[model samples]
Target: MAELPDWLRSIPPWAFVLGFVVLPALGFPISLFYLTVGAVFTDPALALAVALACMTANMAISFAVARLLSGPIHGLLHRRGYPLPQLTASTEWRTIVLLRASPLPWLMQSWLLALGGARFLPYMLVGAPVQSLVGAGMVLVGESLFQGNAVWLMMGVTAFLLGQAALTAVRRRLRRRGSAY
Candidate 1:
């Protein structure tokens, strides 16, 4: 396997933790952290927890920032011809889940949730778990791949595929039931 760069090796654990929590909110590619955190932290479970916590923190930060700049963001989107979703209490949960499940970037998801007027309670409740779970799986899969462990890699990929299948089933059911998210 390839060795981590000297600069990466020199970073302290605390700095890594802080970077994991802050950089994504600043529009850094979160997958860089998700995929490499295992190599830094060593312990898979601890790495998973740390990634989840950082992701949740990033979500909150993104939402707060989006709320603070809602007017400007709305104007920008309006100029770009993108219509914001109307998130009612009834649709907020599903919409939040769908957004989390979508392939959109982390910051975009949070911004949409906040700018679309999702309630704080449902946003955290539905958004955090869904994003965290998907992110944690990425960490696990990444860890196994980096470690060259075929079994764990297969398990992670299988679990991810199953999760995607379940999500697709849920989407179909909602569509069949005429639930507008």
Candidate 2:
């Protein structure tokens, strides 16, 4: 990846805290990318801390975005000629939970929440720990892989991702069935 701009580096530590730390809480993808990159280049401890912090930020942002977009998102979906069955259905809680618990890409959840107009508070409440745990696990696996422990690292990451995918698929199926109730 290209180096962060010198101007970005020149920004005060507080700026990094606000942009990377605070903004990500709002479900911004940049934060996740930043955390992952940091994990790749830094020590595990730092990576873990950054991942936790990013997760916190993601929750805060998701909540605020969800709350604010509730009406607008509904309207936009209507205008865009898309079905609201998934978004407006009562399946959000389960869907969000499964998404959070899964090892699928973090951005998928963030985008779903953002675009679906899910409730911000609930999304954050559900998504924070899920993202954090997955992220930390990814970092740990990455570290091990970097250290030449390819078997363990590959196994761990594969297991986590597969588990997440299974859970998400099952939750989606259940949600679809529940919507018929």
Best of the candidates, lDDT:
1
Residue 17 Cα positional deviation in candidate 2, in Å, after optimal superposition: 4.9
TM-score of 1: 0.89
| Candidate 1 clashing pairs, residues 3+ apart or interchain | none
TM-score (C-alpha) between model 2 and the true structure: 0.58
- Candidate 2 local lDDT, 51-100, one digit each (tens): 56756775666556555665777788789997455455466666677667
Off by over 4 Å in 2: 1-19, 22-41, 86-90, 101-108, 114-117, 145-181
Question: For residues 17-123, could you state the per-residue lDDT of candidate 1 as single tens digits?
Answer: 89988888888888888877778777888888888888888888888888899988788888999868678887788888899888898888888899999988788
